[model samples]
Target: MKTAITAVSGQLGRAIANRLITETGKDNLIGIARTPPKANDIGIEIRKADYNNRKDFDEALKGIECLLLISSMDHPQNRIPQHRNIIEAAKARGVKKIVYTSIVGDPEKNGFSPVVKSNRQTEEDIKKSGIDWVIGRNGLYIDPDLEYIDQYIADGAIINSAGDGLCTYTSRGELAEAYAHLLTQEVHNGKTYHLVGNPISQAQLAKYINDAFNTQLTYKAISVEDFRNNRIKDLGQLVGTIIGGIYEGIREGAFNLKSDFEKAAQRPHKSVPEMIEAYKQFRD
Candidate 1:
């Protein structure tokens, strides 16, 4: 049996690809990316599958038994149709299973509802598509803060619209490991799992960073409008709007969900402090 992972050049894609390679080996895994050359180093067969091109998926997913559909970062308007392209192609190509990396958000409460709505639509479509499917509703990835540690110091604090609301933070690496099992196991079919660590407020996140990297920082809550216009100005409108919207959801308590990570992965997720300690060792 063969498995394919889409968006293989991305951070989450790369992490999942690596886990698949380690757990199931490279011969059975295919990395699907828009630019095949970009993921050439992942030690597997790389195939071209642009989300916008329905025909590309027909060719790329050929003979694959299972698929890991990493959610596209395309604008919400474009996502549903784009995802349909693959789901249709998967059926045509006889791909038996598809595991999607979706997100956890309250569509009514989240300013990021547009994106969440699209994902939910895709989930419904998948269930109706006559194919075996599993969906993982991922929490907020902790990578942005980890990557922005230096900037946090330069700015003298961590600032966002998240306020005192708890964010369900999980790491890409941890989620990837779970996805490897999700992609391969039939037991997870027809289920939606919340893949998250314990929820933490922005100030608690700062405290973990301080404990790990030995930096003093505080969380500053700001208005969603201010964040879009000022704090993430460098990210431009599209991304800044989406990110600002996510923080707004955080502030509204949309992300404070309990985890089903153990049920999904058959193991408990590591705590924030435990993960931070591991990160510190790697950084050192």
Candidate 2:
């Protein structure tokens, strides 16, 4: 079975592609990226394709049985156009199966979140396209450095999330494993897997980081509006607003998966402490 992995140059995409290559051998796995993937240096197959361009997308889907759509990084508003393009391309090519990595949120109750809405639309398109599909509703990724970990530790406090509302943030590595499992198994088809790690509050997260690094870190709960207006930058208003909405939804219990997560994972979940320890080892 041939697998074509879209967005292969990205963090989560690369992880999934690498795992697939290692499992199925290099020949069965193809990497689709706007630019060449870093794995090209290690002899993995890389194909250039722009999702926005139909011809490139069609060409990328050629001879591929299963497709892994790692949602585009373009602005939230623009994501639907690309997704529609991909759906059309996939339908025309008659791909046997398609797996989408979607954001975690509920649109009915929470109004519209750009991230969640885009993926929800994509999910509907896939379902109606007559292709077997797997939806991975992934949670927040815990990237220590990107998350202003230094600022938190230095101030002895991590700011600006609601009180003790559990978010089951998954490490990139754990997400990779779950994605690989879905890609390789037929049983996972037509299933929406809530791919999350151990749930933790911001306070627990801070303490875990502190314990792992042997430094003092604390969690400070603050209003979402204040956090968005002050802390998050570089992302324009649209994306920022969407991010703020999702976090609010998370605190309101939108991202919470069922207790059956352990059953699906078939192993104990990785806690915040473990993730911090792993990060430290990588840094060292």
Candidate 3:
């Protein structure tokens, strides 16, 4: 089976492509990205495609039987249209199926958060495109930037606006494995799986960081408005707004606990501690 992965340069997209190499062997998978992938040693075909242009989208889907639509990160604006262009091009090329990387919950019910609103629209666009599809509703990625937690640990303090909000965050590596599995397995084609891991509160996250590094890292929950005004002023409005929006989702229980990954795949998800451990190695 020929499979194509969009957003090949991204964290999740690159992992999916790497796993496909192991699962399917050489010459069976294709990787597409805004810029061609640089890992020439991986021994797979790499192609370039612009997410905004339908014609360039053709280069990625031309002979593929399935497509993995890893969401575009041109966020705050342009992501939905970029997704639409790719979906339409894949349909036009007669790509047999699509697997979209999305966020958890329905748009209407998850309506309060702007992040969910855009992700929901993208999910809807994929579903309506009539492609045989699988939706991987991924949770927050434990970003390497969280290594800043190391500084907080050393200083014995962390600052944040979220207060006891229960949420789940996934390692990008774990999400990649799930994405790769869905692409190769036919059974995953028609379902929506919430790709999240262990439930954690923001306070619990501080505790985890403190415990991991063997230092005191206490969280100070400030108002969102206060966080923007004082802590992140240099980040510009778009960055601050996006950060605020996600925390708002957490505040409202958007990323809270969820059912286990669908049992048929039996894939394991990674926890916050596990991700932090791996990140420590990277930081060293």
Best by TM-score: 1
Clashing pairs in 1: none
Q: What TM-score would you give candidate 2 relative to the actual structure? A: 0.91
In candidate 2 the C-alpha lDDT for residue 147 amounts to 56
- Residue 252 accuracy (lDDT) in model 2: 83
lDDT of 3: 0.74
TM-scores of the models, in the given order? 0.96, 0.91, 0.89
Off by over 4 Å in 3: 37-42, 105-112, 230-232, 262-265, 282-284
CA deviation > 4 Å runs, candidate 2: 37-39, 108-112, 144-147, 232-235, 259-265
Error of 2 at 282 (Å): 3.1
After superposition, which runs of candidate 1 have C-alpha atoms over 4 Å from their true positions?
Answer: 281-284
lDDT of 3 by residue, 156-216 (tens): 6766566777778887767767777777788877788888888888778888876777777
User: After superposition on all CA atoms, what RMSD does each candidate show versus the true structure?
Assistant: 1.3, 2.3, 2.6
Local lDDT at 81 for model 1: 95
